[model samples]
Structures are given as structure tokens and as C-alpha cells.
Target: MSPVRRRALVVTLPFALAWAVVLAVFTGLRDRLPDPLATHFGPGGEADGFTGPGAFLSVASAVLIGSGLLIALGVLRTRTALRAQRPVVAIGYGTAGLLGYAFASVLFANADAVRASRVSEPVWQLGVAFGVACATGALGWLIAGRDTAPEDDPEGSAAPARLPLADGEVATWTRTVGSPVLLFGGVVAVLVGAVLAAVGPGVQAWLIVIGLISAAPARCRVTVDRRGLTVAPWFAPWPRKRIPLARIERATSGAANALSLGGWGYRITGRGSALVFRSGDALFLRLATGREFAVTVDDAATAAALLNALIERERGTSEQRG
Candidate 1:
């Protein structure tokens, strides 16, 4: 294994082992806990539903342990040797860390409830769990580093040459792509919300929020201009991504299959990050830093051509400055 891969294994396995130990400890102490421990809380922090200690332990352990094991397997089975697979390893370890912290939060909350004989506010417990998980994830990122590489600019890197732009000249192209995945997600969320509404308003409210968020990426805009490339969802602009023309190394048009990219909607895969909407032509961007990004949108060929022209102009300007 490469040094990077070894480091990833080291960073990931500890969290898995730690969570395993925690599960064992919790199981040993289950007798002291209440029968049917309160697991879910309402909006006002009251207990919503209860599950037996055995059931809760089994379900939580299965999910957390299962995720950790799957990550380890993927890392071990990856075909590339020199390639670090840093994002995969980091995300895997980070998710395990989050699950570990969440499991601890549940344990502590239930421990307190068992002592008091009542379910108190789980909001604080879960909030703290989230904070800790983020910190743990950040630590994993630090260990793995940025995981970016420079693209090898072999011949035929750029899209077929377009009319070369004059120095300081500007051009732009814009298009919108609708996401079927987002639509499907919204539908599923709505259906789940309706089903959960039969239980209680508080539980259903969570699903409603999920549905709204799921619909946010229903349509996204792609803009390529002198400034750079921008990908922003129609529902919000603050979360947009901008790639300055200077950073882009190459541009090409090709198919954007979600299956190859490992699902869709703001995906991070073996290639890099992408705002994937559909399984069709996309403008593929290779940055100077070696990172890759793709935007699946209509009229990708024009976008790629215009982008390449701008990049060439930017390179000429930079060379003159040097």
C-alpha cells in the first residue's frame, strides 16, 4: 500500500474499534437502563417513541458497524495503488466518527433518563454530538490533507479549438439543467412525511423540512464567463461554486452518468466533485490543482468551447504578467 493509503487505514480503523468498544459497554450496562428506552424526541423535547434496549442496541450497532466495515472493505479493494483515495478514506472515517459520537449521545441521554425515570431534552445531547462529529471529521481531513492532484495535460486535453478570444475580450454562456434525482427525492420525502403524519405532528415536521431541502436542487444554472465557471442551484445562490478561469487547466464535453460518478446531486467521487443532474453530456473541468469538476447541463459543447477560449486568454495574460 502507498503511504497515503496506509495513513487512511490507520485513521479509519481506530474509530471503528472505538465504536465497537462503546457498543459493548452500552450492552453490558443495558440492565440498568429502562425497559423501552425513549429514543426519539418531539419538537418541545418530550419523548415521542420508545424502543427496548436490545432493539435500540441492535439497530444502532448494525448501522454504525456496517458502515465502518463497508468503508474498510472498499479501501482495501480499490484497484489503484499509487492513488491515495484520500476523500473516500477521509469521508469513511469521518462518517464512522459521527456515528460513534451519535451512539455515545444516545447512550448518555438514555443513561440520564434511566436515572431520572423520564425522557428529557435530547436536543442538547444531539447538538453536542453533531459538534463533536464535525470536529472529528475535520481532524480526519487534516490527517488526509487536501487530496488534490494536478491533471496530466497530455495532447488533446482541451476541447476542439474555438475562435481564440482577443486579450481582455469577454464571452459568456448559460444553461439550466433539471435534476430528476431531486424530483424523486422530493416525492419520496413527501410520501414519507405523509406516512409519518399519522404518528404525530412533530415527527412529520422533520420529514417536511427534508422534502423542502430535497427540492432545493431541483434545477441548477451553469454559467461560464470571463470570470470563470459558476454552478448554482436556482433555489439559492449562496451555496454556489466558482472556478476562476486561472485555475482551470482544461475543458472537455462528455457524458455525465450518475452511476459511474456514484449517484448524483453534488457528488464527490473518485474523479472529483460535480453538480450532476442527468445522464448526458457535461462540461468537464480539470483545474490546475489536479482536481476535476463537472457540470451536467444543456449546451455543454458551447460551454466547453467558450470556457477553453477564456482559459487560453487567461493563460496568455498570466504569461505576459510573468
Candidate 2:
């Protein structure tokens, strides 16, 4: 089978199997387990909080199934089959092992306990779960294997473009782009956080933090000049990403989806680093170090042409000096 298909399975199968095992084990432990299992423990490892079997299992399934599907989607949807794999695989297996062991331990802890209050969790089991996670993580990394460098990715070509420039003449290109998706997501996250604070988990504060960070820069400025490309949030003077002319090998414009570079925002995949506020037309740069940089923006063609022209001008001046 194709490697991409294999990678999807490699990352996704572990979570499914883990969830299945949990279900099977729980079924066998029905009579032995307390009706309301002691799901939470105190610092001393004594049972402090209780939950029904259905509720505990639901939470476990959500954690395992939801995360697995998300990672699988990321792996399957990336533009290149040569995308980074080791980290992705490691995270998948590590999460599966950690949660799997924790869930299993909880079930075993409640086993034969006549009542929830009588059950006690072994604090040492947390350490053991981490150890198992680390070992399984290594296994996943081995399974994912090596991947080709970004320079070898077959997604698209980087044919250089040139803007005719007279001697002593210079040009610059600039544009501001915004992502509605980011703006919407930020607002929703904050609202959800607020609602959750009133009705659900106390982790709502994190959601608010994420929302603020995401909403702060839905719009960013993309500039291409003799200095090379610079990207900065609209509200900040300090640019988030910058690529100097000396480091760039060439510039090109291409149709690229932000997701292809791996989930939005600034992402570094096996293909390259990208500042993707949104997806669509983008300016691409192949660096002197054999790495790539990309940013989604309108008028990307103009930005790419200007960058390429400036590169040629620099090369000509260097050759004359030599």
C-alpha cells in the first residue's frame, strides 16, 4: 500500500485498538467493579470523587476517539506523502498509551470493591503509565520511519519569476490579509469558555487565553522588498517572521492550502515552514539552506515576482564586485 495510507493507519489504529481494549476490559469487570466507580483520587491516592460507569466510559471514548480522528485527518490531508511523521506518530502512541493505561488502572482499582469509597488508586501507577507511554511512543517513532526532506517534496514546483527592473530602480509589494475563520474561531472559543465556566470544567480560562491569542492577529501584513519578505501582525511592529534576501534561493507564487502545511497559523512541516493566516494563493521561497517558507496572501504573484527580481539584482551586484 501507499506510504500515506500506511501513515494514516499507523497514527490512527492505536487509539482505536486502545478504546476497544478499554471497552472489552470494562465489560469483563462489570460485576467486580463498583456501580459508581471511584474515578477521582486525592493526593493520598484515596478515592475522593465517584462517577457512573457510563459517564466514565463516555469521557474515555471521547478522549481516545476524538484525538485519533483529528490526527488521522491531519496526516491524510497533508499535500505531500513525504510530510513529517515521527513527531505525529509519537504523540499518537504516547497519548494512547497514557490514557489507555490510566483508564485500565482505574477499572482495575475499582475491581472487587464493594463501594466507591473503599477503592484506592495507587499513586505509583501514574509513573508507570508515563513509562508505558514513553516506550510506546518510541515504538510509534520506529514505525513512522524516516521521511524525505522538504526539498524533495513533489507537491509543486518553484519556478522563479522575474519583474523587469532598470538599473538603480527598485520596487516593493505589500498587502494586508485577514482570516475570517480565525476571527470566528476566536470569538467562539471565548464564548464557549465563558459558558463552560458557568456549567462545565474549570479549564475555561485556557480557552479564553487561546481565544485572545488567536483573535489578536486575524489580519497580518505581508511585505516583499529588496530586504526580502517580512510578515507581521497588524497590531504589532515586531514582525513574527522574516526571511532576508541572503537566505533565499528563489521565489515563486503557487496555489497552496494552509492546511497542507499542517493546521493553520505558523507551521513547520516536512515540506517547510509557513505563516498561514489563511489558505489559497501564496508566495513561496526556497531557502539557501534547502528549506522552504510560504505565506498565504492576496497578490502573491506580484510579491513573488518582486522578490525574485531583487534576488537577481543582488546576484548581479555580487558578481560585479567579485
Local error of candidate 1 at residue 214 (angstroms): 3.1
Q: Tell me the tens digit of each residue's lDDT in model 1 across 1-322.
A: 7643664465457466656866876876666667777766677777776777778878777777666665555444433231244444455556776677766655666773554337766567667766766676666656555434332222233445565677667678888889877788787888878877776545676776888677778788889998899988876786788999888887887654443343457778566777767666778888888988877887787888888888888787779899
Cα-based lDDT at residue 134, candidate 2? 97
Task: Tell how far residue 173 is off in model 2, in angstroms.
Answer: 3.4
lDDT on C-alpha atoms for all candidate structures: 0.68, 0.79
lDDT of 2 by residue, 67-86 (tens): 89877776665544433456
The residue pairs that clash in candidate 1, if any, are: 149-290, 150-290
Model 2 Cα shift for residue 226 (angstroms): 3.4
Alpha carbon deviation, residue 9, candidate 1 (Å): 3.6
Model 2 pairs whose backbones collide: none
